[model samples]
Target: MNSPADSGAHRPTPVAVVTGSDSGIGRATAVRLAADGMDIGITWHTDEDGARRTAEEVRAHGRRAAVRHMDLTELPDAADAVDRLAQELGRIDVLVNNAGTGTATPFLDMEYATVRGVLDVDLIGPFLCGQLAARRMIRQGGGGRIVNVTSVHEHQPRVGAAPYCAAKGGLGLLTQVMALELAEHGITVNAVAPGEIATPMTGQEDEDVTSTSRPGVPLGRPGDAREVASVIAFLASEDASYVTGASWVVDGGMLRMGPQAGSHLESDAWRRP
Candidate 1:
């Protein structure tokens, strides 16, 4: 927890706060950033052990790692973890709003609480955390990076994920607005839209993405977590300094298959939840 301010002669290292680092894309992003020479602030909601494992990976890269519990469903309060991480890690150079939740229930059957919960975690939570990180970056007088993890659903819709799509779509636009407003401060904001990655959320944890067949997808397989992480890492790096207000799609041509998929569908199976 020692900050550079605590040691007069020590220089501050870049630090990144990645929410939901318990596993999957978040974990991969945390480790990737660490490999790029950044201290990491790792957060989890239900999987503390997984978060600890991610922290170990960061430490393995010879970087400091701070662990915190972040329940995005708790709203504005949960965002306080961002500030706490920034404080513990000295400063926040990057913030990856990777923590998110989704639902597969049909829209007509969805409950108000379920819809609200999805919005809270996938949208409002990142909104608050982004504010916290941006303010800290402004106060610290340096440019920063903010990467919101959206899904391909952010740009397209599915049969059963009504609230999930709504939240992610809203987040996609939010990222653009944030980028526009934070530009003067030299802070860049962007969104990474992933599709069918081999993550726990998709029920394919630790599976070899290449072995998994995704017939509808042009790549013929789901993407690897590391593939998504690599794009995020680039966005968080100086190479992306000129890039902001953009949604980088890392779906291995999935998004491009929309027309092809629609034309080839033979039954009403595509309409079911």
Candidate 2:
């Protein structure tokens, strides 16, 4: 068994496969990891151009990069995607399951297909990808890291976001379970639950939702994708070897907000002018 502490051991250049790397937090995390000395495998759903841009950013950091086109909605195909990444990029030592979709429909209006689509991409997709990455890591005789990009909603419910909330909640627990099951193999699994981040998906481009006045959330402004990326990169690094089965909330203390009746006002340095 290869030990993580062995300094003389030949450390293969780390390879990280980040799904949904075409934009947003995934793309940022991929580039950040590359800058931290890891080669990157970037996966995209519809934006080949965006993935290529991310690849370019990685290369700018003097790290190897490969881009793959993958649709996370095809949950069963994730295994093949991971296999292809390992074969092409050399081997995957880190997996970031960041591909997901969100819907704002009320529960009563949510079609079965809508619910399934959310679960397939956010929950099942991560499970499949994690399994594939873990198997390859074990075979390579070294431990690896898996980071699931969940949301602050993973612990709290919101109006008109039933399916998204459910999927993310399930993902949070799945992260813990994966950690437990893969611990023997020396793999660590964790989650980064980000609050509102300035991204295309969150409608921040069209409107501002970062108001600190938004009750409950202490952070006055929306988080930057790079901020979330920083946490994900840390989790994927060797420094996080002992941290597993945990969900790091990078939500600017948003999840701690209670209802108006129970509200406790708090100030955020990130919010202070």
Q: Which of the numbered candidates is closest to the native, going by highest lDDT?
A: 1
Q: Candidate 1, which segments miss by more than 4 Å at Cα?
A: 1-11, 259-273
As a whole number from 0 to 100, the lDDT of residue 126 in candidate 2 is 88
| Clash totals, every prediction | 0, 1
lDDT of 2 at 186: 87
TM-scores for every predicted model: 0.92, 0.88
Among all windows of ten consecutive residues in candidate 2, which has the lowest summed lDDT? 258-267
* Error of model 1, residue 209, in angstroms: 1.0
Where model 2 places Cα greater than 4 Å from the true spot, the runs are: 1-9, 205-216, 259-273
> 27 in model 1: Cα distance from truth in Å?
0.2
Model 2 lDDT vs. the true structure?
A: 0.82
lDDT of each residue in 53-140, candidate 1, tens digit only: 9999999999999999999888779999999999999899899999999997998999999999999999999999999999999999
lDDT of each: 0.90, 0.82
